[model samples]
Target chain A: MSWYEQYRSRYARLKQAGKPFFPYAVFKDMVVVSLILAALCWLAYFAGAGLEDLADPTDSTYNPRPEWYFLFLFQALKFFPGRLEPVAAVVVPGVSVLLLLLVPLLDRGPLRHPLDRPFWTGLGLASLAAFGHLTWSGYHSPLINPTVEKDPLISRGIRLYREMRCAYCHKINKKGGNIGPELDRSAGSGSEEWLAKHLRDPQSVTPNSAMPKLNLLDDEIQALVAYMKSLGEPFTAEAPKLFTQNCASCHRIGETGGEAGHDLSLIGSARDKAFIKRYIGDPSKTNPDSSMPGFKGQLTEVQIEDLSRYLAGLGR
Target chain B: MIAWVHERTGLDRVWKALFERHVPEARGPAAWLYTLGSASLFVFLVQALTGALLAMSYAPTPDHAYDSVRYITGQVALGGFIRGLHHWGASFMVVLAVLHMLRVYFMGAYKYPREITWMTGVCLLLLVMGFSFTGDLLPWDQKAYWATAVGTNIAGQTPVIGGVVSRVLKGGSEMGAATLTRFYAFHVLVLPALLAMVVLVHLFLVVWHGISELPERRLQDGDPQGP
Candidate 1:
């Protein structure tokens, strides 16, 4: 008899002597399904899913990360830059999937034991290891935009700013009414104590000021101060010259400059002013492997702020 | 009454075939490993239930989607819990599906008569990912917006048909109202039907071929010795 025929007959005999599926296999399935559902319920109750702010396409500083399972693919795409990015994005995954679909045909041997099919077994383990490593790397990668929404104080302050109709009187980023000074220009430059005092009683700092007393609690005052402080002051035109003098050697913005480092033309899209400021002060603090030297001591604080504000406004 | 129904429909015979049919015993850890497929099925059911509940409260539009999600999470009774289940269930489904595939692969259970089963399973895995990708856009939050934007842009990287593929996914040149409504239809209407059909085929094949008996190390050759 042919080996296929022999194998089929042997399998038939094995089934003939096997136990019924109803009580045995079904029981095991029930136990597992129950356990999984219980755990899922626990997670759903204790750790509910969170929602971020409304979708704002104009908020280019928002960093985009895929769900965790897809992170490995996202990380894998980083290896291929520019033109070849499509290969990592498409071709490699396409080939791997095609190969997976053809696995039965590829390893047609009748050996059912993994030990007997050492090559296939090893290949499976290697794939799993690669997947695990890629996922770990993706998880550990530094986020270009450390989320502004993560800070409750800033979020609350923003909410309060809207509730108090601060925009009705004070201009900010050139959007609010022109009755009061632009907060982006002057409000952020004040010391924490001064800003807090101003929020609590507006006329104290600037005599004959038209602003009214907000009558906010201390915590509310603190929150507004933090929010204002987080805003970037306007950068000087000299900011572009500073970049050309120092950053253009390695970084590329728009059409000109070297490409030793990443293209910073769209840097504003993923990173906000605060992040750029910190990253400029000390690259190692945020990204240890960064080859760029820190400009903390080399440049003055005002220069760094100006540079960050300049970079932060780029792409947006 | 049960007997009369059984006689009229041959229900007992069908039940016996489906539930009482014999399976070759899988020993110890292998027996536990067999539960992964059923576990995945359970998670799928959870997703379906929670997804349906979410749909009741959800408005699939750019203007209302985010607000609707917030309402469901904050106001609707037990809404947060249900949404949480759906969110976590997606991850659970992916993990369980991969683990089950690994079990089948390592056991060489996809051989011969079960090759069709394996192929259908691959389709189901891809379908699960489809479900995830489509379901993500339903929230219409910042993460949903930016992630989907990046994801479609990646699809646009395909060699020749890339632009067309991404446009179809986004439902236009840009991600907007059309994208949200398109994703909603796929997530709620299209993928579930495809997944259900594929799953039925997979289950049918599993029963038809009989779960391949645990491979014996000693029977490396085509030997017919009983364990």
Candidate 2:
């Protein structure tokens, strides 16, 4: 008899000597499924799924992440840039599925044990390893364009800024009217206290200032100050190269550079330009435990401004 | 009553064939590993039940989808709980399905008479992923909208059929009301039907072939002796 026939006979003998499926197998299945059901209920009750804001098609800064199972594919797409994205997006997954479908046909040996089937076993383990590594990398990778709206106070400040129509008087990002000083340039220079004071009573801070005290509430003044502080000056191309030279040795941005410090890709969401600038000037002033060296006297004021602006614009 | 029903309907024979059949013994850890497939089926059933409950309160249109989901989450009794079950059930299904597939692959259980079972199982796995993709858009939240946008754009990156697939998925050049309705239909109507059919075939093949006995070290390197 052929090996296939021998195997079939052997399997038939094994089946004849085997246990009945109903009580033996069914009992185990019930036990495990009951455990799973209990766990599902526990998770459903405590860790309910979340929903974000309503779909905002106009919000260009929103960063999207796929479900966790697809994160490996999402991360894989980053490696193949430009026209080759199709390879990562389509051909890779298609070929994987095709290979998966063809596995039984390709490995037609009678060896059923993993040790006996080295090649297939090794391939399976390697695929599993790759999947795990890609998912880990994807989970750690920074958001593509982290929106400031992730911060509730900052988002509230944004709404207040829009509602107050501050753009009517001050130019921001060179888009608003030129009736007042450009907010991006002027705003970053003021401390939070100074900005709040100015928002409350402009004449008290600057006697000849044309800005009027709009009779705002304390919370409104705080929000406007926060909005003003968030406005950052535009930086030159030299800013990134400066970051590469000065900070990349100790800091990381996205998938590139070093990792000695906290990742700065989402730093802008946490810290405004003024705070970043102060920290950069003297790390000890803002963070007493910081091991980073001060760069106040080392870099020129213009270069520092450019660098801080570039960093502040990150993830926003 | 049982005999009367069995006499007319012949249900006893079917029950004997399905439940009273013999299965090759698997002891120790191997026995536990055998439960993954059944566990996956259990999770799928959970998903179907919870998904149906969610559908009762959900609206598929772009205009009402977000509000309806919000209302369900915030106001409806046990709505959040059911939605959570469905949400976690999707992840559990993916995890269990993958684990089951991996178990089958490692055990070389797909060889010989079980190839069709493995093939049907792969189709079921793909159907589960389709369910996830389509169900994601039902909430109409920012995460859902933008993720779907990126997902469709990626689909549109296929070499030749890219544009067509993307357009069909979106139901237009852009993701809008049409896309939401299309995804809702697939999530609720099409993918579930496909999943149920594929799952039936896989389970049928399993029963028809019988579960492959755990390969023994004695048979690791040599051919089995003929009966």
Candidate 3:
């Protein structure tokens, strides 16, 4: 059969076999579609959506993650830093979709076989695979959620701390200001009664102390005290000089410090004396990626011994 | 009684005009591929239905949007299920539409007279993506908040009209109540309306041109030099 005759006959057969565009096909589709929808409702009944904590803009520790479907886009953004970010977020995805839309106009191939449309088919498959891989990795990415679940009283105190902007002058963990001390490390030494007095007026509790009177309610003061007392550590009067001079800049032993280094508030609880001595003397000996400057040449042997002993005493 | 009513209205024409249309024969596995477009349409309708129900209880202000969603999920009967349907339906719609496009493209159905159909399809895909981006920030949870911030920040980084586009998306320098309201309006009103219009046009084009006969079984209909 010639191509023209084949085409005419195909149309003729199609016209003869064609049914009314109504109940016959619509009914079949409705049945399948309704069944699928029912299955979706059933699945939804079993697996409810997850809801997390409310948004707290003040909480510096909050970890943000995108929805599962958007993980690929989110991961892609990580690759393009600074000014080049728009390239990853917009240009690449935009260009890819534009190219996809252009496929129809560009590929005027008569052949429908998958093997014949190698470029378009291969591009689609490759993009799909990359999307699948990126989404999978995005799902498996390390959690950015808050690490600790604070007790109720401590949590209330944290809210108050944020509202009061105490962090403007005082840090908790390694987060606040350097004006006063980091409340996390500094408060560990204060007794509940002492924090209460300090909350009323810092001048009354410690002379020459520049801390302001927060004038907190009694219950709020109690909550703050509870929060402070919870940050417990055995007072290490011996190595205070060394810690203040070196580690305090980065690592927060209790509350007062910068966040560029590890929070050492619980390091004493986790590390042994020997490990501390070696790690602090030369952090690279253990963690190749450790950003801590080695104190090997800077500190005397006696000073290293004192610092390690002080840290080791901070047991969990 | 039903037969009497149907006979008077001549409602069988509805069925005849819709479901009983002549479908061109595709060889082998290719026949199953034709169903994808219908499947995508089905999922989209489902999304529309569920999204309507969701919007009834969804507050469009930041102060209440997140809480309203929580209440819908926790307090209202069947709310959680309806929300899941809407959520999953959006995902399914995107997947199915892409598959439909893929099927059409690989089958060489986009050639010649079908260019308009192909172009409308690309528009539909863009609309679907627009729906996804706008709908995502409605929940106002931590994930929603920060993801939106990052997403909009990317828009803000664009040169020239970057700030303007970002402000339009967010309704201000910061994302707040106005942003949520704008997104709600777009999701429920604008995008869906645009999609419905596009979808109707697409269907009309499909019916007018008829489903592209298998490219392998090419007709020697004019334009001899045509691929």
Candidate 4:
């Protein structure tokens, strides 16, 4: 007999042979299913989800990675290239779904055996394999941008600066408020002791300054100073653009931008390039009470060297 | 005690009719195919419970969505666990639905009288995709933001009607506060209700058509054609 005829006769013989949907079969299924669900709950208790840093629109340093299931599409975008992006983004996936929805309508044969209909069954298997391959490849793809670890002292300084809410008045790299002078570009303007005393009692260093007394401990002031002393003035040439992208927000040369930190018009005269370089790399090394954030790993050493050169050349 | 309640409500008859109903004997290897539907329903139930818990604390807005998620993950007791359950449940449901539809298709269950069941199954698959697209955007992270931009851009490629469709799906020309609200509405309200309705119809059809028996398996006890 033909496959379809054999299938029909077999169905006729088996149609009434199976068990009921309830206690006999469903209950048995439920026992195993319940265990599977409970296992899921157990997994939740053990493998907790990940939480990253708070979303910041301004920080271009971050590399965005989607959830695992969507990674294939993320990887697929790389293949599209430029204006043809819509092909990968839409056309391909779109047509595949349309074909999938049309499967039942297109294939109306009575043959139950998959071998009787090789085309659709083959297509399904092929599509599944393709999706699996794409997902696996996506998971293995390298990160586009990698973030370097922060220094311990700088990390501590950052914590203290945020905790103290110093950013409210004093600007750092264009962030925070415009009430004080910019720190990154205006690094060499303040001496170590002067910077310390200023943090302890702002009125002492700069009379009529609107800054408040944070009432921080000696070590806290030192860490804050360490942070500030790290801010380097931007170098000349291409370094100025880097400064604008990374530093101009808080630091200023004259009247060009924010005044949250001291003016850097004459930063070259106040400190040499080596001193500026050290301060820019890790401000805490120079002024223990500084509030500036160090950019050791954030900026490459070469960029820092160029920026320090530009800073040393300033005011001359 | 059980008999007493049944006496008052006549529920025992209904229970007997439902539980004792002679389903086409889905014996041996063929019975395994029935597993996916029930499993899909179970996953949906779990998703509903977890999703409700998530909604209790979730704030649907541009400014607070990310922070609220952080709060849920970090501060709320078992919040991360609930979120994980919902996340995995969605993926599980999609898998189960696909497997169920495949079984039906391979069995020729969608032929002739069961065409509606097969079509509804396709719609359910579409709903799963919709849920995936909408749920990803709720986190409001960089991944959420940019992926959604790409996803909506895909929607905007819908041939002649791409512009209006994408605009409506995003709730505007650009993704912002309205996009989040609209997606939240569709995710929490619209999809669940629609899914529930479709599920009821699918179940009703299944009950009416009876469980499909495998053509390869022979009768265990006696001939179904016997008088």
Q: Ten-residue segment with the worst summed lDDT in candidate 1 chain B?
A: B218-227
Cα lDDT tens digits for candidate 2, A58-126: 666678999999999999999999889999999999999999988888988567888778899999999
> Pick by DockQ: which candidate is best?
1
- Where is model 4 more than 4 Å wrong at Cα? A1-15, A146-177, A187-208, A213-304, A307-316, B1-18, B25-30, B105-108, B215-227
Taking every candidate in turn, the Cα RMSD to the unseen true structure, in Å, is: 4.9, 7.4, 7.6, 9.6
**Alpha-carbon deviation at B122 in model 4, angstroms:** 2.1
lDDT of 3 at A12: 53
lDDT of 1 at A279: 98
Query: In model 2, which runs have C-alpha deviations exceeding 4 angstroms?
Result: A146-316, B218-221, B225-227
lDDT (tens digit, per residue) of candidate 4 on A1-316: 2444554455545545655567776885697579759877776777655544434444444556666666777788789898787788778878877776667678864544566567866877787687788889988887654443434565457657765677787776567888887666565457778889998998987799888887889988787777666554445477888777777877897667566666676676456689888998999998998778898999999999988877765653
lDDT preference between candidates 1 and 3, better one:
1
Give every prediction's interface RMSD.
1.5, 1.4, 3.6, 4.1
> Which one wins by TM-score: 2 or 4?
2
> Per-residue CA lDDT of candidate 1, range A169-206, in tens?
88765678989888877775689998887777878887
In angstroms, the error of model 1 at B30 is: 1.4
lDDT of 2 at A198: 88
Which stretch of 10 consecutive residues in model 3 chain A shows the poorest summed lDDT?
A19-28
Output the number of the lDDT-best candidate.
1
Deviation of model 1 at A61, angstroms: 2.8
Q: By lDDT, highest first, what's the ranking? A: 1, 2, 3, 4
lDDT of 1 by residue, B120-186 (tens): 9999999999999998888998899999999999999999999999999999999999999999999
Q: Which residue pairs clash in candidate 2?
A: none
Q: Give me the runs in candidate 3 sitting further than 4 Å from their true place.
A: A1-28, A31-35, A141-243, A248-316, B1-15, B27-29, B214-227
